[model samples]
Target: MKRTLFAAIAMAAIAATSNAVLADTPSHRDAVAFVDQAKIGQNLPVIALSIAKQTVTFTTIASKLGNAGAVKAVSDEINALLPLYQPKWNENIAQAYEKSFTEEELSSLASEGRSSKYASKVLAQQGVIGKQMESTSKPILTDLVTQALRTVMSKTP
Candidate 1:
C-alpha cells in the first residue's frame, strides 16, 4: 500500500511538471499519454509523429497563426468526422477520455482538408493530400494501438 501510494504521488508530480512544459500543445498530451502507457509496460516510446514529414496542399486560413493554429487544424480535421461518427465517438470518449476532455459539451470549429478514409481512397493518386493522410494516420494508429495495449495491461490478472 505504501509503495503504491508513493508511486502514484511520483506519477502525479512528474505529470504536473511535464504538463507545464506542454501547457500550450494539446496534441502533445496524447503523445505523452502514449509514452506513459508505454513506460508502464516497459516498451519504447519513440514512435514519433509520422505526419511531421508529410506535405499537404491545404493552407491554414487563420490570418495570424502559429503552433496553436497547427493544433487547431488537426482538431478541425477530427471534428469533420463527428457528424458521421459522433455518436460512437461520444461513447468512445465517455469510456476513454471521460475525466479529461469535455467533448460532449463542446462543438469544434476545426475543419480538415479531407475525410477519414482519405488515405485508403487516394492511395494511388500520389496527391499531397494522400501523403498527408498517410503521414497523419500512422502515428495516430500507433497511439491507438498503444492505448489498446494499456487497456490490456489494466485488465491483466
Candidate 2:
C-alpha cells in the first residue's frame, strides 16, 4: 500500500511539472512581442469601424434616425471606445501567435523586425491565424456594436 501511494505521488509531481513546462513552451511575452513587431494590432481600429458599419443594428439605427450628425456621433463614440477594447484585441492576437508558432519562431520573427521573410512566414499562416481571431473576436465585436446601438437608440428623439 505504501509503494502504491508513493507511485501515485510521483506521477502527480511529474504531471504538474510537465504542465508547467508546456505552459511556457511558447511564452505569452514572446507572442506579444511578435505581434507588436508585425504591427498586427495596428489595423484593429479600422477593423472595428468596418464591423460597426456593417452591423445591422448600426445600420438600422442610422436609417431610422435619418440624422447624419447622429450617425457621426455614434461613430465617434465607437471610435473612442476602441481604445478600451484595443488591449483585449491585441491580447487575442498575441494568443493566436502563441498557438500558431513556436517560442523560437516567435522570437526570431520579432527580432527580424518585420522583414519580407517574416511577412511571408506570417502570410503563409494567415488562414490559421485569421480563423482563430475571427472565432474569438466575433462575439465580442457583436456585443460592442449591439451595446453602442442600444445606447444611441435610447437617446434618439
Candidate 3:
C-alpha cells in the first residue's frame, strides 16, 4: 500500500512535469525529434517499440502483485511522457536501416539492460511486479507497433 501510494504520487509528478515541458506550443516533429535524437544502444529497441505506437500495459500484472493503483498511475504517466520520447524513433527506422547494422550493432542494442542507465532511471522505483510487467509487455508492444507502422508507412494497407 505504501509503495502504491508513493508510486502514484511519483508518477503524477512526472506526468505534470512532462506536460509542463511541452506546454510551450510544441509540434509533432518536436516530439518525434525527441525520440530521434537518442543514441543507439540498449534504448534503441525500446524506443523503436515505443515509436511504433506500442505501449507498456502493466495493469494486470500490477493487480496480481497488489499494485493496480500503481499500474494505472504509471500507465497514465507513460501516456503523458509519450511526447517526450517522440524523437527517438530510430529503432523503428532501423528496419529500413538494416543494411546499416552489422551483426554487432543488432546484438549490442538488444542485450539485457542495454540501456541500463536510462532504463534504471526510468525503472528506478519499479518493484518485482513492475519488472515482471516490463518483461511481459515487450511482445505486446512489438505487435502493436508493427501493426501501426504498417498502416502508417505503407501505401496499401
Candidate 4:
C-alpha cells in the first residue's frame, strides 16, 4: 500500500511539474501529432495496471502493520479511493496535453505521425529514451535532493 501511495504521489507530482518544465518552450506540433497518430493513448491501460500493482503491494505492506482485519480495511480503503481518483487523474492527463501543446502543433504532429516510417522512427527513439530515463531517474533525483539539502543547510547559518 505504501508503494502504491508513493507511486501515485510521484505520478501526481510529475504531472504537476511537467507543464512547468515545458512552459518556457513552445510546444512541438510534430510531437503532439505523433502522440495522437501513434495511438499512444493505449498507454492508459499500462498506467492503470501500474496503479493496480502498486495497490496490491501497498496492501501487503499495510497487512504487515497489524492484523488481517486491519489489512483488509486498508486495502479496501485504497481500492475505494483509487476509483475516485482515476477520473481526476485522467482529466489531469488530458488537461496536461491540452495545455502543453497548441492546436497547430497537434495538427502538424498528427500529419507527421500518419506516416508509418515516421511513426516507427518516433517509437524507436521513444523506446531508447525511455530506457535511458528509467536507468537514470534514481540517480538524477538523488542528486537533486542532495543539492536541495545542501542549499538549505548553507542557508541555515
TM-score of each model, paired residue for residue: 0.21, 0.70, 0.23, 0.34
For residues 1-157, what per-residue lDDT tens digits would candidate 4 score against the true structure?
4443333233233333344434224343343334445544333333433343344443444344444543444334444444444443433332234343455544455665454333344333443333332332323233333333333334332
Off by over 4 Å in 3: 1-49, 53-125, 155-157
Candidate 2 yields a Cα-based lDDT of: 0.60
Q: What lDDT score is found at residue 106 in candidate 4?
A: 46
lDDT, model 1, position 92: 24
Worst 10 residues of 2 by lDDT: 11-20
Writing each residue's lDDT as its tens digit, candidate 1 over 1-157 gives: 3333222223222332222333234443443333233232111111111222122311222223444553354344434433443332222222222123232211110112133233232233223322322332333334433443333334333
Q: Identify the runs in model 4 with alpha carbons over 4 angstroms from their true place.
A: 1-27, 57-109, 114-116, 132-157
- Model 1: runs farther than 4 Å from truth? 1-129
The models' CA-based lDDT, in order, is: 0.29, 0.60, 0.34, 0.38
Model 2, runs deviating above 4 Å: 1-26, 64-71
Quick one: best lDDT, which candidate?
A: 2
- Of models 2 and 4, which has the larger lDDT? 2
Candidate 3 structure quality by residue, lDDT tens digits, 1-157: 4454333223222222232223232232232232234332223233433343223323333434345443344444444444544222232222212222233443333342335333333334334323332333344344434443443333221
